[model samples]
Target: MHGRQQPAGHRFRRSLTAAAAAGALLLTAAPALAGDGGGRGGGAGGGWVDRQLSRMSLEEKVGQLFVTYAYGETADTTDPDDVARNRQWLGVDNGREAVEEYHLGGVVYFAWSDNLREPRQVAGLSNGLQEAALDGDGARVPLLISTDQEHGVVSRLGPPATQFPGNMALGASGRAADARKAARIAGRELRAVGVNQNYAPVADVNVNPANPVIGVRSFSGDPHLAAELTAAQVEGYQSGRAGVAATAKHFPGHGDTDVDSHTDLPVIHHTLEEWREIDAPPFREAVRADVGAIMTAHIQFPELDPTGAPATLSEPIMTGLLREELGYDGVVVTDSLSMAGVRETYPDAEVPVRALRAGVDLLLMPPDLPTAYDAVLDAVTTGELTEERIDRSVRRVLELKHDQGIVARPFADVDEVAERVGPPRHLTAAQRISDRTTTLVKNDDGLLPLADDGGSVLVTGWGASTTARLAERIDARAGSATAHWAGGDPTPEAVDRAVAAAEGHDAVVVTTSGAATAPGQARLVRALLATGKPVVTVAVGRPYDIAHYPQATTHLATYSYGAVALESATRVLFGEVAPRGTLPVMIPTADDPGEPLYPFGHGLGYRR
Candidate 1:
């Protein structure tokens, strides 16, 4: 099942060259299955999967059902933090040892866990982990390495990996093509480092403005728009020869809840009809697009299942609805088993078993891997779960691996990583996509397209980095600028300084993030407005923030604070690109709950 080892540089060059040569052909060609099966029945690489399955022991099959996490960039690391995290989670000192001991079917990387560093280093880490999974004393199958490279705020892979303006920014653009292009670029870049799975294209329709977790991550408030973008991204992320598998997530929708599942379980009161209309469109479209996986949410939908089980543990929701009704044959993965939404209701040992029973093919980030693995093994031993049932999921897992080309081309080219990740072309595409998403919500005073008077400008915002970046961009594009980082909920002193500083500038630019909840941000905006300088408000975080300071005459929304997004906002501010994006979600009036400050689809474009 494993390929012979070669020098890292030599192997990477060969693999990358071959992949590049095949890239164009693979775009139009059907996904290559490992063997003669052609459609999910392939073996390790060239043989039959059934033959491999028949030879597998119960323990091995059990291992294939679990996708675990580990820390450290390499299999062997001396870093104290890496050792501590790996030992704490996997009962091992390094990722390689964990793979060998548990026979892990997959591994998910996270920035905080030190699994992702840079392109070349990440490629090396991926190659090392693959060696352990395929040649070590484990499942002897290629491991499905995954990460939440959702871009925007949820991205794990950073610089040199293209930064997208996130889902809401895509929503504001209202162009499915942009979504597809962004995802394709992200897919190719991720594949360069050998990460084959992307837990992204968040399928939730964020109808609730207060949704703490899914706000900017979601595509839009409208289900139909979300559906279109979801399918487009699925296709885009799985397009090229080096395409990584894309997972559409938070099934049954985590959009309407104000609660974060990591903190507590959120129960959705949507009746079955409401669920179908409001939340199911995106996942339905994802399945139609042949998405590699659909991740179940931890939130509960009582109307869908009266049993009160969260989607992660509910057979009625996962199997009955997602599997039977939706007719999705792809892998069904559970959200992190460690989340309070799933764990609060069940014991640590029972979470994985219940998730599997609920039709989850892969268990992600269980708090304790040893206990979870043992619980699943014990369940099979006690007949609580059948060996055949375990085999079913392993087959699905293996199928995804083969379909994604991981079985044949699991190793990334160390030499090619720098060239392939975040090249100029990808960066241009990212900036273009971000530019299209800048929404000019209001310009009552027509204060934009700052006069080239070489005037000084005041750029103050919540994030220190964001403010500095905006100021620098504006300075280069037009005039002298001073940046002040007004912390979120700015203190009175901070507001006073910004207001006093406004006297030196011809114009004041205020950026807010979640200002609806931060009274101090509103106060700062009002104080700057009272300064009598033309005030231009950029809602760099939430478009909903506009309602918090309704007195402001000019407003724009980038829907993200990503570097490219701020650049896009600056372009729009100076009229480099005409603002074309409209509101994807309504902006309610802060003073009156019933009226909207800005209606959905509302936007103002600069006059020709």
Candidate 2:
């Protein structure tokens, strides 16, 4: 309201000489593959977006930049404690309240948003929110409903949603084609549930095994391989039913940093040259592919910008590096502003404004919406932020909506929703993919394909949950597989008892995930191996577990613990499926050659 209305002859502009060149290089390096150009900007609804853009008030333009969380459900919170928690977590009662008050452009649903079990309920919830957005007091453009449907452990959607094998699993398979298929399934299932944007296909080239956050979330440590898979996943995602946008996130890369941006600001000290080699490939490929959106990382790139500001707030990084150097014309969204990485540095009201100044198209989950909205409004009035800048981002957002056809058909089919998820063929395909991705990284003792002549098998691990799951899977495949000492901390007595029990079985299968971070689990594995009972070890999560217990008779890695993955791994051991998975990452060992102990692209198959 404070800025002059309809500021004429204006286009959003910022200096980005380097970003433009790098983006050009990336585009030239690969063909410019992108949005179908089916939507508004260059698509059929171009005039519609322009018409809406022209009539929008300054406040309405700013509202489009904000996307807040749709916390808990609508069951009416009578308890004061429940009310307080809802307010703190979600910022409003439901999507409708946020939409009407802030004229929000979108809402992101988390697991707790609704106890969504049936896909019908999810679609209905999304439809109701869209209807609310349409009738709300704001700009009334259709809301962009989104969720984090990254496959594997990061999958936010619960059962029946076809949790495909994760990135590392795909990487291990060494099949870009399979990655595309996995993405198509993920995107399609998400769209069926009334979700449009998937903030996934993490392009981060995870270079550090100790990187607590991005491990296994990333495709691989090798930049080129990550880029190839990243491009493939993006291409597959946008092709899904109703067309969901795939975002290549944690820009510049969150791979090398050790800190979790969710809790603290992680720093990346790579020189610009090193960055081009280590971090920039995946994002560049994403840009060249014409991905619909690129989410900025919260990590600091002091070399890119000496300001010490996180990429979300650094104009040099967002505008100069990402926008210009990368030539990313698609929407540039900031990672959740609520994360401690930026929030600890910039408090409530100032974060959104700074992000806008830095050239962000979308401000995601600003911890405090009211305060952030008013601050951006105040910045416009004070001329610290210009109306034209707001306008450009709003148009991009609208163009994406126009492109996705959210404006025309925002609601998903409630009855068809659940039916669309996890088709029989998709489950079968998932099993097939999982089966091929089980890598046999080590077999010094060559104890795999444990004797199947009615021999008893004992599955033992530190935790009872996975131990039980593993044992049941093996039993289902082979006749005799039972837990030696299921699910508990690795007490010496417990390890002794499990070791004792392992001797009675024809073979022992030990599962381990926490070796890199937890020493106790490694001790348990070594103790089991020390029993000299032909123990076969499964590195359930990261493949790094084998380094701690390398003397195991046989070692394998599933790259994930998802049900399909675990089942595939057990099947491989029982000789139901031959292990075809390769090592997507190096597992460093003391006797490592020029390459790590088990170099990348190393996997064993059944004896020919």
Candidate 3:
């Protein structure tokens, strides 16, 4: 659920306020130095990263290549005090100590302080953590700060900050430009708060509607559409000219999986040819476009890597195919090693060692950093993992740092950074996409464009009656309309209310939020249809959910519940904007469930 812990109380607030002020002052005075010139000659300080790596012993070098998670004994807090306390407790306070003592290559920020609600708090937290990483003289490689900010469901930065729709919403909109805009906005926002890397632009194509975790996260079920949208997002995020690096992820693909990798390791049964035709296209596009990094998925593909290990720790997947065949020379990072896919399948230390041998340069979110570090060290010491292999990984890691400008300039002013991060233009872009992408699936009987005359109107379903945006649109259309929110499941009380309202109104409108298969939502649709009044059902989730209430007089699928999607749906309902969006995926019915419900490019327009 929630990640990390937070500090609480006035003391925490005061401390954070002070730290932010101090960090702001430091930023103003030191200002980030341009990579053009200054500091350390060709060998001494000039090539400090190289000099330091060369000096590190085999154990130290192995340690330098690891990026570990910081765990604590508490509910993930966002409070500033918890952040301060966790920093000390998790050994994050001495980043310099960890790096200098163990020769750690990088540290990933996972359990952050909860008090980081405002932009200033984020700046302060990053500044303080980075300060700690530089603690002991000049022995540490600059730590890489990362977060999973994949908009919709996987957003770390909350409130006051702009949040965009998930990938499925973008797919429904039928526009690649919107996807690119979303990425650019996300990139600038991330860079503003001192996050250098964003683990996003989910390249997975959700061909299976039953996919639980990645339903809305994926771009589209169609491989070509997914590739086109992914490429657009990559270009957009990198267009800001900020040093932020974007990672196209879960390669070779995680779309067709019905099982969640968090609990169990799911297998990809597609053959190499099937992969090349469907899954590999997006990854190849990303590789050709020169993405900064590629993250391996935790899914096991027996057809590809017969060892039964997930791709994250597979040499055949990471090295032979991605490196030799695809020619990707950028940094190769692993997914979190804590997932059951890695833990349940292999020995603790073996995952990291095998991952490295498989040509992975960075080990992310290991179960135990120190133990994992020692294991790699012991392997190198025993000549199990050659020094040459260590050098290869370290070199790639350092080169990435240099390219990202992290090695050249350690830090920047948080306030100035904030200015570049949340430009109003980005939010506007999100709003634009949300407005354009929402579609109207079907509207039979021409019952839409409710009579302008004021009358009792019943609005049911999740998005139509619950979401503030959709509710506002419906209320705006009818001067004095009464809305009864079904809340995903309509009870007898809800049904009675709907019937009561329908008794006084001309018609009833029921809307569904999320997908059709959402628990109890289908029952609400059946209940509304049972009322026997002229009923209009609108689907505000994916188009596939429309098959449930086929008996309804009117049915419309907007393919999304995002703000923009709601706006477009309202426009179609009010006869303002003609329904132009076509179905990108097939929606299956019970009788012909095996056949595509609404084939690709299915739409209905009101002809005046």
Question: By lDDT, is 1 or 3 better?
Answer: 1
Candidate 3 has a TM-score of 0.82
Cα RMSDs, all models: 11.7, 9.0, 13.2
lDDT of each: 0.83, 0.77, 0.66
**Reference-based lDDT, residue 530, model 3:** 73
User: Considering TM-score, where higher is better, how would the candidates rank from best to worst?
Assistant: 1, 2, 3
Model 1, span 402-422: residue lDDT tens? 878888899999999888999
lDDT of 2 by residue, 309-428 (tens): 888887777776677678777788888988999987777788888888777888998877778889999998998887776777887899888777688778888778756898888888
In model 2, the runs with Cα more than 4 Å from the true position are 1-41, 74-84, 88-91, 484-489, 590-595
Clashing pairs in 1: none
The TM-scores, one per candidate, come to 0.92, 0.90, 0.82
Which 10-residue window of candidate 1 scores lowest in summed lDDT? 1-10
Return the clash pairs for model 2, or none.
19-324, 19-325, 20-324, 20-325, 23-325, 23-326, 33-289, 39-403, 463-487, 464-487
TM-score of candidate 1 to 2 decimals? 0.92
Q: Give lDDT for model 2.
A: 0.77
Among these predicted structures, which one has the highest TM-score?
A: 1
